[model samples]
Target chain A: MQTHSYTSRRELETYHFHPMVAALVPLAFLLLQAFLPKIFPRLLILDLPLVAVIFFAVARRSPIAGTITGTVIGLLQDALTHQPIGVNGIAKAIIGYAASSIGVQVDVENLTTRILMNFVLSWVQSLLLFLIFRYLLGLRDTHLVWLHELVRASLNTAVAIPVFLLLDRVKLRE
Target chain B: MESFFSRFKNQLVLIVILLVQTIALAVQVRRPVEPGHPDAESVRLLRYWASSLMTPAERISTGFGHSVRGGWSSYVGLRNVRAENEALKKQIAEMRLQQAAISEDALEGQRLQKLLDFREHYVASTIAAQVIGTSGSEQSRMLTLNKGYEDGLKTDMAVITPDGIVGKLRLVFPHSSELLLVNDPTSGAGVILESTRIRAILHGSANGRVQITNLTQDSRIKPGEKVITSGGDQVFPRGLAVGVIESIVPDPEHQPYTLITLKPAANLFQLEEVLVITGTQPNLPGDAQQQLAADAEKHAADVSAERLPSIHDGPATEADPSKPTDETAPPANNSTDLVPKPKPALHPDRYSPGTAAPAAELTPGSPRPATDAPAVEPVRKTPVAPETPKEP
Candidate 1:
């Protein structure tokens, strides 16, 4: 059996990524999110952008960086959609910040922690989107089906596992 | 101030980001890009830049995927080619017989329409475009087309497949356009039931279902009834197949209104190529000259048939002057009261050569020529008439 060490906040290590990796990884995810479902519509259940945001935010462990990453990626995702811009931006920015803050407090390097973080944060991201769309934007048609959202978050979590592992190879120990 | 900023830098950044996005959202919500006034410049520019940045990669990926799939399907997937081809040939033969029958009906319809001076809008021109990507959000339900403003696409242009209507162009950038699918929550179309002719507004639900709204429970709508565009909204042409009703249930939110769900006529999820309606022209009398001549010949034969003693004797007994005589009466098979009339010379000002007649002049109950024979001289030949099959 493998053993892991619990690190304190001060001793927790933050990771850096190559500038090309940082930029291109999210772009690739966005492209996949936009185009892949055209071939296999069932792939729509996978939130690739959300997985990317969570992975990068948790890896960096910097709230400001996570917030900015979330904002940029969320706005880009919004631009591809017909809906009013910033709905995804707001949801993701908050999620990014929260994910990073959690990253700082906990040893996110652990497998179980990463899985739980992704699942919970994925659900929270959906909830934030629902609240923002319903309350702030007054999009009365936006209704959240709990079961559908649960499936989405679960699929996102499943995708995040392999995506985070692949991305971790690109992370530079800072 | 510097120390305070340093103490709450992350929180401040988050708040500022959220605030800016909220303000932008408010601006968009306040000044939506309504039809004919798509002047939300900043948002449009942002979307344009984003699409431009992403379009090349999407196009390359889409093209590569298509090439790979085509190669595999063309070369390796030949399991039942002979059987499928034979079946298709049989279907074509059956359809040819049906086409002959339909052609006669169409000619009769044209004669009646000319008699009443009825005009209708038809798809005049279309641009074929490839579906490259999607909005990637279930809530938005938009498609990204490879063609754009440079391809002569504009907002609100109807996008359709041979099977049925797909959507309308929502945003046109330089090299790409966004198509708001009919199943998007924000999308709506004017539709009518085929059998009952009950008109209603079609709406898209949040769960990506197309539905008809604003009908009471007492409405005689049934599942499997076909729905078609009414052309009242001016987006889609009249009689274009929209979808068929899948199910009907009472609306829980809106009292007394039934929620009628529709199964889209087009395979919206599997769309690869679609035709954008670039232009439409009103169906005019001179547009169907070939049909008119054929109908005129048929009417002459019918008159000759009616003059026979056995066939003419039955209606001659009750022949009132107000009713049509044997010479003017339609064929025995046709039940329409409209008599084929000789077409009058089109007004030079209203239907000049190389010009289209005004649609308003052909409204129902409009003044029509008094002649009852279906013979008319061709005024002008349209190079690309609506009846002509276009190669996409």
Candidate 2:
């Protein structure tokens, strides 16, 4: 496997998590994303599955693995919804790939970097969905409330701060 | 070619995967399965897999929660049981008397229905299901129920609570299904004002609030007027409680249409268990007499919210039909709660001797009739009750 050498700022070591953690984390996120809203509907603003996709993608630093993870998780999220599948899958795939590719060069370990990445990626994902629903699908009512999106992004990023830290503890080091 | 593939393998894989998914989406959109029909095979399989993975965990957790609450209520608490039991007995006695009159009115209404050859659908059966999860996005307002294909749940089946209609079942898996809530922007319902009878199209806004549109400026609706399903959408049975009108404003974009906001009857966010209406059968003249007896028996059997008389189906005449009990009485003030108040009996003069006039014509600020008004009006007016046929 050929990995891109984007930078030499620091020695980069590959970390491989236990395969079960890799599988279970995403599954748990998907389940909670689907389940928590039933108990506290306001929690919908936090997209945990998207957060997990970003965390795993950055931690693994493998664009291929990240893209695949995004695809599966996104599809699973779509399956839980009534919308036509793949809208989320495509958006998450791009986010996963971008985060991982960025991971390869930039250091995502800094809390500031992690927060900024999640905030930017959340907007990107929302914009992608808004565009798909509006132009591609010709859905008339699909309009993005910029303020709501901004607030949601902030909330997701805030959640990602702690979530990424917790998830990091579960990762197996090289 | 090998060198090129190796250099951009990750990008190439991501593009390929996205393209495949896009194609699938295109296929689904192009051949959009009609609502209420089974989804496309692949989507159905995907849903089955997703539900199979998640619903078990949800069921276990929900069951555990229920057990704890039930245990607390049963063994750990009984202080108010005596007071509650005595109050319920009194309520039941009062309902028995009202039940007798409602039964009579139901029979007369059925005879009128048969006379007019009125073919209408009523909820024939329902399966109780626990709400286990949701779509987790306010944009996609959906609930996941624990009952599914194995439980005879089907797409487009009306889901409800004792308070009002919730939504329709959008998809069914083996052990779980998705409820497309009425608050979803994509959802639309035909609804009418309880007293005004002004029909309009109700659609969910982006923020999960329901509003009525497609109303002509000539339509007269008030803020506190109760909204009920008009049954024109063919999804919900006519006369089911929907919501209370919150406000009405002219739609600036659509010249002739007014925008009326509503507060839904059931607490959507607080849902735990709901009924999935499985089937509906039309009322026929042959079954009308038999249905009358069955209606009485059904009303007798279940003395809970299911049997409560609809406030929308006010007595045909303004004469107090029965003693106003807390359960049956409309609130003293409509603005007291967010839940739609039970409608009081319409003024006797609203429907004139021969022709019915629009309820908006009633004199504004005219004092409402006292609850203890005479209860002996002849059963001349056709009752608006739909709850009788819903039993089963």
Question: Candidate 2, clashing residue pairs?
Answer: none
Interface RMSD of 1: 0.9
On DockQ, the leading prediction is 1
lDDT of 2 by residue, A128-163 (tens): 989878876778767899999999999999999999
Q: How far out, in Å, is residue B20 in model 2?
A: 2.5
Runs of candidate 1 exceeding 4 Å displacement: A1-12, B36-39, B76-82, B115-117, B284-392
lDDT of 1 by residue, A34-60 (tens): 999899877877778888888899888
Measured by TM-score, how close is model 1 to the native structure? 0.81
lDDT of 2 at B187: 82
The DockQ figures for the candidates are 0.73, 0.56
lDDT tens readout by residue for model 1, B1-392: 99999999999999999999999888888895679445477778888888987899999999999999998898765877888899999999999778656766767776787898977687888999999998888878888999999989999999999999999999998889999899988888999999999999998888889998789885577899999999988999888999999999998988788989999999988899999999988763454556556656776777766664435566655446696556545444333534565444554332334344445656777655433323334445777544522222
Task: List runs of model 2 lying over 4 Å from the truth.
Answer: A1-11, B1-3, B97-108, B283-392
